[model samples]
Target: MTDEKNSLYGGSQSSDAKSIDIYDENLHLAEKQKKIFLAICGVFISELNGKEFDVYMNTKTYTNVPKNANNIKEFGQINFESKDDFSARLFDRLQKTTHPHQFARISSMLKKMCSKMTSYSMTNSPTKLFYELSLEQRAAAVAKWSTSQKASIRQFYRTISYVARTAFWLNPYGIYPAIGYPGPDPEKNGPRFKGRTFPEYEFIKITEDTNDLEFDVVIIGSGAGGSVAAARNSVLVIEKGHHYHQSQLTLREKDGYEKLYELGGGMLSEDSSMTVLAGSNFGGGTTVSWSTSVEPSHFVREEWANDYGLIHFMDDDFVDSIKNIKNRLGVSSSNVIHNENNKILIEGCKKLGAPVATVSQNSASKLHECGWCGFGCRYGEKQGAAMTYLKDAKDYDVKFIQDCFVKRVIIENNKAVGVEATINNGDKKFKVNAKKVIVACGALHSPALLLRSGLKDKNIGKNLYTNPMAAVYGIFPNKEVKAYSGTIQSAVCDAKENVDGEYHGVKIVVGSCHPAMMSTSFPWKSPLQHKQFMLQYNHIVPLLIIARDRDPGQIKIDSKGLPKLDYKLSPHDAESVIAGILTSLKILVAAGATKIGTCQTEVEEFEIVGENSLNDPKFLQYLEKVKKVGVSNGQACLGSIYQMGTCRMGSDKAKSVVNPFGETWDVKNLYVADSSVFPTSAGASPMITTMSIGFYVANCILSEKEFVKKRQSAMLGTPNSTFTDNTNADKRSSRRRSLLSSFGSKRFSMSN
Candidate 1:
């Protein structure tokens, strides 16, 4: 067995049979080289000793030095006139160290000292210590070190550690032949996909020849809600996006975004204040979401029933709908294995005495291997709409048309007759007649569709609710938190629940730590700072805050009929987020994090020492600053994964676009069966709720006495004698004129 010292610091025996030691009469080195190595190590020890005895031991004096020694000049008290002079001195010292073995020993000592000093200082600091710094400050230190200094401290340590263990030191100063660090090979960390294509199913390509297709029911959008509705009824589903099976997924960030997201995953609010990440592929959000299947909270349900006049949501039937959706989607918490990221949240929340729960996911335990859930589940373990509802609908002879963009619903005599669409960017142009048409194109796009179809209801595109989200990252220097190892979101903290007034309804969940996603969302202080954070990606744990916004925004269409999201954070919602940040800080401190920071572009971070430091007046002042400069400034990194209530459903036609039964109030046969129909925010992940809404709407359409009778008559090949021509030429002309006047010359054409 190899000795521990031999394994750590190189074996005693060398190829030349010479013993390695600090003092050897045969080993001769210049006097200047020795002095340089000692000087460099001395400077490093001075900084470390300062942090240990002055900053860590004294709480009041902590303010004297910057956290993490970010300003090295100030922290080190090095006066060489200018930064260039300081670099020159350091460079001159490194250039003089010629003997590889001696330099390696010196490097190893410095590296060991750095590691020991960090641990020792943190241990001696107050029982609860938090470091408040911005992403810029962290990145700046790394950038400054790399650019200004000729010899990198990190690189020097790596070389020394490698040579000490392997008896090979690279001459960094160009004196001897150069050799790099002989560290062990790094483990591969890229994603892997092992799925084959799903069995082929019959689908229409919607070319010119097949453009004039007809069906009993026409469903626009093949996502969560549309797929459910299609399964309930053997409907014809028209998806604007192409369908790709699990096998087709590239599992790369750029490829996934281009193929599976709306607008190549670059969709942002009109003012760019928030990024809206909604799925645009066949399976919709389920294909790209993290598979967290949180059901609608009782508070949201009660609010909808009592305030929004959605009383039917409280019925027993709705309960059954939720249960059925849950069962179908395989929502379960038993199979979840919380990764280090989630474990941190659990530990922190437990210590803080905050309410936390394991998140229920829509994935099969046996099949899920903790793959990337944000990308399309290549293994089909996730029971998204594509795997379950759409598959079932395919078995039931439902005709699915891919790459078919529906332009508008053909409304005549106050009822929807069919829809006109251009397939695959004008490869085919035609109309499809149907008894009923359901719009499930999400909250943002659903309103655009209605507006383009000449729907004149005053509430056609109002009351849009987005669950605005932000993230806070904790740096746990002592632990290796591989945030991407397990499921993306396995646990949640509900500490901000049920606060008085509009400050209620904030939820914190573990967030994805995928390299690409984090790089874009993490605050950018400089290129060097950003790179430095990326290096420690595995050690960082991120927590996401989902706030239920009280103030509603709106969705409008531009002149060309494209959807434009107009949302700004409300004062109350901002307060809620700030409160969440404060609570997250407490939780992180409890979880034993040495540093905590929000992802906001501009905000101060805290390096905490001492258990009750959070209650300090200085810390409270920092919280006040965060509140004053909220995330709504259009510069902070804010995002929304859940959107709802654009084309709301309610009892009053004057207040809503659709009735409680999900049918459009003005247009008889037009219905909405998606998050667009949600009367208000669901206050949680909306996958199951959206599915339930689809189920309920389909049932409502099937149960309608008139609709059932009409279908039966049509099936029997008999013309109902009671049917009369309700179309008056003057009324039709008036409606057409009104639509044309409102939307310029763009008009809906009918296939006679």
Candidate 2:
């Protein structure tokens, strides 16, 4: 071994991991490039030795913030776990967690990224290895990349930063202890939900020796869509993810990503301009999301009917569908207790005279003040798909098999007969023979599934819209505790939601944040500064600037047949995001924030000098800096919380993958019943919209008690139902019976 003083890399291997060597793994990258990549990782996350200890987070060489302004304090008292072999821990997890090919691609990119970073850094020659430079010099190098004149350089920085920071804050092993973050809180001692447990569902695990099964219908997902569509008996819902019950609902940040989210909660667009978060568990997003139950805005409905030919979206049936689902889920804002974050948002919006409204939750109107909603609701109060639709279907003996990945739909002579799938990551090959098939996979995966099934419709993966969001955080030091433990979005602003007159604008709301989530999404200024912000996690509150994106992205499959999102922030959408950021800053200042931070990586945080209004000259200048920096390609941190619009439902076959009834245009008897069927972006939380569409499409399949009958019955009541409710059970059962009997007798077919 080389002498300790002459070590080439800054640190030793991470943790106790022992396995494949990066160089031995036949990667297509050069040896020097691989070393360069490892060095860069060392620069971002390390143990902070004698020369590296920084208390005040002096980053002024790159950012314009005042030196030693003393807004944030040093955290020397606490014993941080990251101080002991953090670099080693991070690399150990990276090697074990990331796929080999993906790692190779990242290493190759890192070499190029470092060269450009140094050139832009205005430091020493690019010949020096990035890690060999002083700590500040290295951070300054990376900081310049965000403000680089070249878009490519900016994108490179964004990609690298995302990979590095997410690796650290998403908690490989040491992060929770290092940052002092608590894991899932499903305890009896809590004030809200007390010692409640979910009733068990009969979930079968698919095995290598499992036999073929037959059902009346086979649904290829278990989210809000598939759960509702499983209204018929003899139905089989195949889920790619396993069932995460109450005991494991809200896992720790890292565990949650591995167990509940798609792509380990790090899926990104092709350009890395947006981070896409989608659930992969049995209940899907409804299980893990913030449960913001909202009906479609009226303007969005008008667009679907007038522009996209989705007339039903504007009809009374749609309204009834939303009402029926909302009633069943008990979605209401009555019992919401806004956290300090939410309270400040409302106060600031009100002070600015911006229109604001309370956002509803599907927590059964129970007092559920959980900031960890994104990890999956620990409390049983969240009426997710599993608790509502799936629970209802369970009584009818609708079967379910978890850990099943449906490979493709089985098409025989232009009809979907069933589906072929591999369970437990190809441990078992099986086929489910069914009379009808419903592909209820969310937007990101539905298109890939269709394409894999050999459907040639051009719109299968097109027209995708994610209500992309950017966040701005404010520091409220006066709060006794760090401020993020209650409800996640109890309020939203309509001040700029319809700025484009077409409702193609933005919505402002408070985001649910915990330490791991807070730190990862917080752009890294320097190691010390980033850690300092993590120390201030409790005092920080982030506001989401969500946009009703007019521009669209598409989902495409890679050589491995996995979904690859292709999206870039179009100029118009970028403008809307910039406006939202400025508006968010204005609100923060008005709300009496001592310090406000923007997500743009190269920008300086605004520190309150004195008492000031929104129009204060210094604050106005900061706003201008924000606007000028804008949503530069990959420079600003943006996220897609509700991905939608792929495989959209419409009348024109050339423009849409599915028909008005949600049946695919290319094949009969196969339908899509997820957010993918939205005529455009739902322009609101998509849980209600996806569930309503699922309910509507399921009715279409059973040839429901005519539209008029549903309208009349719905008009007479509030449409609520419990798992044991039999009010509409007979009607639903009769429709399914008639449809099944027709199929059994060979007297009816979906193609008819």
Candidate 3:
């Protein structure tokens, strides 16, 4: 065994200069910080004694591990390998995504955890540190903290649990083989058919001291919006993340997050209310999003026009932009294959006579049944913006700089000039002068960037909205239902949506979670209890109830000048979320699930004995129990993959950060063409809406008589092709209006 002090588990630096120089060059955390991080996570890993291990192994008749090991120490919890320690993986993630300002907050949290250990007297040793606690003491503390009523106590448990479980499930060296999860093997996991083979894109990689960059238009993101806006000639796209073609895509959770996500994935909100997942890599959310491509609902568009005074939302040009984006991306419901989860949703909805709709995906050429959509697509079937829009931009000679972070938009007298950025984490810095500047860094970072650039407005980072989702897992013991495979998301149950007729409520959708996501989200009670739940992994199907929050949260810049969410679930939305959960439970009952569980810690699962219906006395009592507890922050895990409305677009200059034309009110020729500019909650996936806004913003630039150069004029589309809207939804039969008489909108107000 290697000495602990000299080990690569983020120990003290060795005296040798070559090894220290090489690894130290990339190291972001101090040796003490790294040690503290590892100690905090190590305590939560739940080291089991011999008897405890036996109890956990015998908890369930089923086992997710194909070759379930009996040894407790070999699981990597009790004893860690030097090279594959949690600190190495954790710091690697930090160096890639998290900024120093955020790290301070994290470090503070770690110190708090240590203080908690000392206060609880868990560490009987003289050191009185969390790392010095006995294995038995640490395990007992985790049990108490996981279900604690206090938010601060729960925060310690959740944050450590997220990192610890990720270290096991996401890493190849941790527990992949033990859990039967095969890491990224192209030959084994990729689709059978060889998908599209893209040409070698000449992305200018910044390796050395390169300077003096210039362009006609400089877009500061590579997401659903920015990729579409890159249609003009002489466009230079600066993406904070690097690109990966189909072959280079790593389907592994750990590698995918390090490469593609904002703040290294499983990102929680400021108050730890919801897990906010935002993409940051080459194609942004398009590269990492579940392939469901939904447009802003009709009611939302009307709301933007009527309430927000953004009448252009319903204009012909706006409608035309949506239509054009759909055509370009080939979004359709034709020949779609529903996975096990979607199939269960459809079957259950039919039994209850609920309205279900087929969702369109960007992949229309062939079946994109490859289940790893949350990670980048190795199959190249899903038509992400990188595949379609950015490829088109490249064909039109639009140059792109990969792995570049824009410091701020260079404004001269409040007029857009260009951008200043650092490539590959401050290795090289340069300024790109441009005629137009587009801020499309998504809902989270776009506002943060504006705040950092000395832009002041009450509405800069306000009006933030998310489609917060809660999960109800139904395990079918009779047959195999691998929820992680096949088409990720393809169907929806809108029986609960628009219950108010003003389009405010919830929608039921299916999600595809790999092992890492599943572990972090799967509700934990005790070590043995969680193991029992996970043993049913292949049989469990999740129905995600997404509440379209009415009361919006605001994004505030923290002391580090970074974006932080200052939002909580409002009473109105809490009712909606709880109502959706109750409805989902009924659907699962109708689907004839053997056992049903929720993300909430207090709610007990209702396992069927012989046969049970929604109206059965036992199930009814369980439903009552769920409603009694309701939804609250820190009680359960709530997650949101969708974020919007931060740098909002509206007609009123006083109310919105950007105007209806997508230009910022304070700055001329500077635009925001992303989900950040959504006037309100889109109430659906914002991919198509975001892309259409980008398309519209690009046209706005082209229409400008002063900025439109001769070279940009050649980008005029020659394809006058008009396609039929075969992807028509929302035309449901009137009989579907019957939304389960037992649980209606009136019952949602559980004030009694």
Measured with C-alpha atoms, the lDDT of residue 733 in candidate 1 is 34
Off by over 4 Å in 1: 1-199, 365-371, 610-621, 706-752
lDDT of 2 at 474: 89
Q: Top lDDT: which candidate number?
A: 2
Please report, in order, the local distance difference test score of every candidate based on alpha carbons.
Answer: 0.63, 0.71, 0.70
User: Would you estimate the TM-scores of all the predictions?
Assistant: 0.69, 0.84, 0.85
Q: What is the per-residue lDDT of model 1 for residues 1-752, given as tens digits with 9 covering 90 to 100?
A: 11111100011111221222332332333444433333332222122234433432232212221234333223333222223333333332232211233344444434343443442321232221112222233223323332222333433432221211111111112101101111111111224344333535567755546646788899998888998999999789987766776666656544565456665454556545566778877788988888888778776775565455554455566677888888888889987887888989999999889989989888854435353667677767788888889989998899887666777899998788889987534545889899889999999788888999999998977999998888888877767676655677888988896545643668998876555455545454443243345445556778888888888899988654657778888877787777787788778878988777786656755676776765767667766776676665554667788899999986556688886668887787898999988887776889899999898788877767564333223322311222212453344334333423432332212111
Q: Relative to the unseen true structure, what is the C-alpha lDDT of residue 577 in candidate 3, on a scale of 0 to 100?
A: 80
**Backbone clashes in model 2, listed as residue pairs:** 14-88, 14-89, 482-538
- lDDT digits (tens) for residues 614-719 of candidate 3: 7688888888888888777677778888899999986566788986567887777788999999988887899999998898778767765432322122112111
User: What is the alpha-carbon lDDT for the whole of candidate 1?
Assistant: 0.63
Model 2 lDDT per residue over 278-347, tens place: 8887888898888799988877875675455555665566777888898999999899888888889889
Task: Quote the lDDT for 484 in model 3.
Answer: 74
- By TM-score, how accurate is candidate 2? 0.84
